[model samples]
Target: MLEVTLREYGPAVSVPLSSEVGRALAASGILQSATPDPVRDGHWLLRAGSRVGAVRTPGGPVVRVMPKTSVRRLFFLLGFSLDPARAWRDSREGTVDTGAYDDVVPALAHAVERQIDAALRQGVLQGYREVEESALVVRGRLRESEQIRRHFGRTPPVEIAYDAYTVDTAENRILRAAADRLLRLPGVPGLVRRRLAHQRVRLADALPLVRGQELPRWQPSRLNSRYQPALRLAEAVLRGASPEHRPAGSGPLAVDGFLLDMNKLFEDFVTVALREALREHGLTARLQDRHHLDTAGLVGMRPDLVVRTGDGRIPLAVVDAKYKVEKADGLLNADLYQALAYATVLGLREAHLVYAAGRQPERFHEVHGTTAGPDGRGVRLYQHSLDLSREPDQLLLALRQIAGRLAGATHDRDHEIPVR
Candidate 1:
């Protein structure tokens, strides 16, 4: 029997595999690192080369493939399944391993259900019972049969053994939804293809249902279409996928990635995603510079992007793009002072600040001229933000709203909202 030990127990419980156990769980194309593939156990095949256990001549430890998993890893794997769209989008950072889907997903339906069943008896899953019955009067009855008014009641409802404190709780719906989609994708190859499709294929969706069918080796529209179709339009790309081909919008829409800069650490992503996202949005974008250049004078200035749409009418729009999980004093202030400096030199009417949208569309406007600068310049500060929690199409509208405000009064609001 495999000895189960708890590695962590606060927010969620985790189990670490001993060398003997880690050796027993090995597979290809899933977990390439030294870390164990906690996502899949069927990849549970032992690595005879690594462990200190007695084995027969045939490299035999009789590794009876545990054909199943416990709730510990089942829910854990389910957690990966939740929001797989976001998961896969983030997977490039090495945050996600292929094992969870390739090896673990198949064995789960049978094993995971049983594990949940076992837990049902202990905690969250125990069912309640309610019974209604009639009662008769006894002790105080005045001789003979006496009428009685009494009743008993019990209500039964099923429960689930849930760890409310687990990350699972924070991501329960996400896990359930992702798991459901994975379960349903077995017969829907097209859906999976679409999910994994390339931008050209999606952009070409209107052109032809030819992604898997054949390549348009010589299709003219491939080079002519103004819109770049999406492989899988997701939260990460919701704003980027906005299909407006205007003077401000037209160009080869690209999915700029730090693919070569992939990092396992989560914080590493914040900077890369922020800068790349800013550039992709046509904000003040700067690519990697190799030479040891001097930024002394530019250390703490403002206006990441400056574009003047009209002829010599303030030749640029000063913009600063900010990326953060949450905004605090340090965050907004950074943009504020930066914009202040930019406005001073450029002589622009206003500066636009942008931030990523989280759960909803939120905005904060800051007025700078409230306090006088050393030289007494009329400094006005404002901050605007977008909530990206809405659908992709809606996010586009939000971006349009920002682009409109920056475009200096040409944005139209009369059209009805697009139903898409």
Candidate 2:
């Protein structure tokens, strides 16, 4: 058995592995391996990808990789903000010790537990639900089919359909199911498992989710707002808990792991942070806003983020977040071209592209001689770099600065007089 330790968002490490273990890791898609190591015979220079989780093989545990950053920072990067009103305190509250978790699953489970505990204190949430029941007396409406089938030889009991206000709602059911699944996972702390077990019992009346059952939709409101964070965490756990399989007979018996796409996580963090920052300036940001780039409606353009007026109809600035490390030259031309298309299609003169810190510093590119507008003015693309390695406060500060710059550019464009 080979012990492989992988860090989040860091350089790859070379692991000497037996042939059997090497095949398992490669098949799992958790590690990327190039040519074999020349210095060491039968060794592979393998690099951990963006995924942070552990994979178990038939032979044994081949590799266990964890995130380099603290759990608090990881949560922030995943678009979760600190809110004291909720029962779960921030990661600094000592509820979950930093760097104590070796895998992402337990860390996520602990976070879920904290949220659930806090939401429970306010009282179990209840909502009006339509329930069908058969009893001696009718309640609301008679179930004609059920009544006829059961009452063919008997008349004492009747089938009824009624609206009952109870805690056995779809939302609660999802939460209960999530807790149940987390309890079965290995490495969960005893305290968390006990809490989860208690929650499951409390929600015994709530129906467990069946295979292929759709998760119920919930609207944000004053009553359910408190459960939002826990609900989000539960959804993530459910998504990760589901079994995943590779092509038929390609790998060993099914392996389980939880991995979040760094690209999506980074984009979400930037978009949400920027939106919050722009709110102070009376502007709003929409993520993945769709627009038709051509008159034929065949070509569609969906920019990562679009800053707009409060009404959300007027587009002010377009920005795209890239989770890639830039080369020595600068940002990729394709990203620039994509941003330029969004700006031109949206009738804006400026666009922005945000990237993770890399070897090159931030720079701006001016594209001249464009026929996008009547005056044939060129669009200016601003490139900004955000250092993910910084602390949460520092990262947030960088986002606010970027938001200010975007707002300022939009303000100038709004007041600019056309030079005829």
Candidate 3:
């Protein structure tokens, strides 16, 4: 067995692997691995890509990789505030102790359990759900075909459908299914597993969903407000814990793990936080604004963010978030090219690129003599870096400052008159 320690979104690590294990890892495609170094005694340089999860090989030791950032921090970055009103009354406020668990699954399991327990204490959330039943007495709408098949000669029997407000609801069933899956996951601590089992038993009256069953839709309202947090957690758990199968003859094993794309996470956080900041200035931000990049409209480009006028039709500033470590020299040419394209296509004077802090400092690049704006002026690209290690308040402050800069740039561009 080989022990590999990887930092979240960090550089790759080289590990000596046997041919069988190497092939398996290659086939899994979760982690990016290079060709084995023959000179280094069959050592393969393995890199943990954007994903953070553990993959267990068939009849082999498990390869566990942990994220550098805790799951709690990730939730915060995703715009989930730790408001007491949004948390379970009996549970500790918004903070999750990720250190207590080795992997994300257990941490998530513990968090979900706390929410489920708190929601259940208020009594199983009862909702009116459409129920179809075949009984001797008619209740609502009758199914003629079903009634004929089940009770051909009987007069009292009928197949009826009605709405019933009961504990057995789609929401409860989804929670139960999530708990059941967590219980089966490997490396879930005994305590968490027991709690999950308890939750499952508590939801025994709810219908059990098959592996690939479609979950029911639930809208949050005043009545089920307390269940909102738990429902969100349950949905995330169910999505992440779903099984992914490998091709036949590759292996008989299924990989079950929870991984987040840091790139997307960073982009989303920036967009939301900036939008919040822009709201103060009487502006608004739209994420992933779709636009045709070329005249033919065949190629499409969606910038990570677009700060527009209050009406949202006029584009002011276009921004793209990049979760990458920049070279010591400067921003990557490809990033600059992409940002420039966004500026040109949007007919803006400037575009913004946000990157994760690294060795390189933030700087602005001017594409000299490139006519990008509607007035036939050159475009400017702004590069900003955000340090993810900072506290939540500090992060929001930085975003506010960035929004201020964007607003300032827009103001300057709007007031400028063409010299020509």
Model with the higher TM-score, candidate 2 or 3: 3
Model 3 poorest 10 in a row by lDDT: 84-93
Q: All candidates' lDDT scores?
A: 0.31, 0.70, 0.71
List, residue by residue over 1-420, the lDDT tens digit for candidate 2.
445666765575666665665565566666555346678887766677666655555554545567655556666665342232231234234223223554666776777777777767787899989998878887899889887887876776888999999988877887887887777555567776787788788778888887456677777678888787777777766764333435245554554545665666778778877887888888988989889989999998889899999888899999998877766666687987898889889989889888877653346676868655555557778778887767766776677778888888433445332212
Alpha carbon deviation, residue 133, candidate 2 (Å) = 4.1
Best by lDDT: 3
Task: Compute the lDDT for candidate 2.
Answer: 0.70
**Which of the two, 1 or 2, has more lDDT?**
2
Winner by TM-score: 3
Off by over 4 Å in 2: 1-4, 9-47, 55-63, 79-103, 133-136, 145-158, 240-253, 292-295, 359-362, 371-377, 409-420
lDDT of 1 by residue, 274-330 (tens): 333333345442222111113454343324455543342443456665543335432
TM-score of each: 0.31, 0.77, 0.82
